[model samples]
Target: MADKVMVDNQAIKKRRSFREWKEDTARRLDIWSRKKPARRKFWLNKTLYLMMIPYLALFFLFTVLPVLMSFFLSFTYFNLLEAPKFIGWSNYLTLLLDDPIFIIAVQNTLIIAIITGPLGYLISFILAWLINELPDKLRAFVTLIFYAPSISGGAITIWSLIFSSDIYGYANAFLIKWGFIREPILWLQTEKYILPIVIIVQLWMSLGVNFLTLIAGLKGVDRSQYEAAAVDGVKNRWQELWYITLPNMRPQLLFSAVLQISSSLGVGAVTTTLAGFPSINYAGHTIVNHLQDYGGQRFEMGYASAIATILFVSAIVLNKLIRKIIGKVGS
Candidate 1:
C-alpha cells in the first residue's frame, strides 16, 4: 500500500492480490537496475497513424456524419417536398406531449428491453461457457446448430411456420392435441400475446455474435490464472469465475453488453417480421418502428429525426451506465 495510486474511477480496479503486490514490489525494486527502452515522439509513429486512416475515415463518413445530420435536422420540419423549416423543439414537444402512440411505443420498447436484455446476456454467456468446454468436433457441430438461426436469411420463414395463424401451426396443433384450447389461437395477431411471443422469439434468436464473443472470451482466458487462483484459496468454479475469469474477460463482456443492449432496444425488423408493424393497437410498437413509420411511411423526416435522436441519446446513456456497472465486476 506504500505506492500511491491515482484513479479517475477507483471502483474500476479491484483490490490487488498477494501475487500482484509482490510483482509490483519486485518491478519497483528492479527499476533502476534495468535499462529503459527509448520512447518515440508522435511524428515518428506516422506509419501506425497511416494504417488507421481507412477505418477512421469510414467511421466518420458513415456513422459520425449521419448522427450529426440527424441531430441538426431533429429541430426542423422537413417532408422531402421542400426546404426544411426550423421549428425549434416543436417535434420534440409534440413527441412528448401530443403523441399518444409515441408514449405507447416507448412503453413497449422498455418492456421488451427490460425482459430481453439481461436474459439474453445471461443465456448467451451460459450457453457459450458450456459450448467452450466441449471437444472440438462436437463443439463445431453444436456451434452451427445454435448459430444458424441468427445468420440464416430464412429465419422469419421458419418462425412464421411455427406460429402461423392457422389450425396447422405447430404451437396451435400441440395445444389443441393436449386439449389446452378448442381452436387455434391467433398468437401473432392478439394484443395481449403478441409482445410476449415476440419476446420469446427474440430470446430464441439471441444466440448471435454476442454468444460467439463470449465463447472466444472464455477460450482466451489464461488457464494459468485459474490455477494460481485455486492455489491462492479460490474454493470452487464460482469463486474462480468471480475473481479470475470475469476480470480477465472484461473487454469481451463490455463488447457483448453493447451488442445485447442495442439488439434489445432496436427491435424493428424482427417485430415487423413476426408481428405486423403496428401490431394490434400498438402493443408491439417500439421506438424504431415509430421512427420508420414517420420517416418512411409519412415522410415526416423531422419527427423521425427527433425519434431517432431520442433513441440515440437513450442508447448512449444506457451504455455509459452499463459501462460503469461492468467496471465494478471483480470489485
Candidate 2:
C-alpha cells in the first residue's frame, strides 16, 4: 500500500509539473505575441496600409485569382457555360502531335520575336537618344508621331489600310508606286510572307512606345554619371551609350524586352485582324489564336487551358533565362 501510494504521488507530481510548464509556456507566448509587434509600429503606418487595401483587393481579384483559376483549369475541361471535367496529359499530347497549326504558330511567333526583339530595342534607344538631343518642343512632336500607333495597337481601321488584302492596299499601292512589285501581293495569305508582314507591322506599331519607355529610363539616369564618364575620356556617342547609357537603362530595357517578347509570342490580334480567323492557310495562327480556336470557338476548354498553361510555363522559363543573361551582361 505504501509503495503504491508513493508511486501514485510521484505520478501526480509529474502531471502537476507538466501542467505548470505548459501554463508558463502559454503565458510566455502570449506576452511575446503582444510584445513582438508593437501597436505603434502597426498603427503608425495605418494610412499607408489603408491606401494599399484597394490595390491589394484588385490584385487578388484580377491577377491572383485568374492565375490560380487558369492553373486549375489546365487540368480540367471547362467550357465557360458548363462544369469542368478532369483530363490528363491528352490535351498536351494532342497539341504536340495532332495539331498541325500549333507548329506553324510556334514558328511564326519565334521568327517575329527573333527579328523584332533586338531591332526594336535598338531603334527605341536611338530614337530616345535623338529625342533627348533635340529641342523639347520638337522632341514632344516627334514623340507624339511615334506614339500614335501604340494608342491604336488594336485598331482594325489602321491595320486594314496597311494590310488590305486588296489591289489598292496602302502598302501594295506604295510598293507598286515605287516599282517594287508587279502585283498586289497576297501578303498574309502565304506562309513565306505572313511572318515578315507581321514583323513589319509590329515594328511600325512598336516605335513611339518603346522610345518613350527608353526616354523615361534616360531621363532617370543621373547627369553626373555621364559627366564623370566624359571627364574620364569617354570619347564618342557609341562609347557613352555603351558605358553609361546602356548600363543605367538596364532595368527599363529588361522590362521593355519582357513586355515585347510576351506580346510578340502571343501575336494573335494582328494576324486575326489582317488575315481573318484560322489565318490564311493557318499561316498566321499564333498560340493565342490556337487557344481561341479551341477554347473560344470549339469550346474545347481543357485543351485550351493546357495550351495557356504551356505558354505560361514557356514565358516564365524564357523570362528567367533572359533575366539571367541581362544580369550577366549588366554586371
> TM-score for each prediction?
0.86, 0.82
Query: How good is model 2 by TM-score?
Result: 0.82
Q: Give lDDT tens digits, candidate 1, residues 45-150.
A: 6478889999999999999999898898899999999999999999999999999999999998999899999999999988887888799899988988988889
lDDT, candidate 2, 272-301, per-residue tens = 877778777787778898889988899887
List per-prediction Cα lDDT, in the order shown. Answer: 0.87, 0.79
User: Which candidate comes out best when scored by lDDT?
Assistant: 1
Model 1 TM-score (2 dp): 0.86
In model 2, which residue pairs have backbone atoms overlapping below 3 Å?
none
Runs of candidate 1 exceeding 4 Å displacement: 1-40
Clashing pairs in 1: none
| Model 2 CA lDDT for position 177 | 90
Write down the RMSD of all candidates, one decimal each: 15.5, 11.9
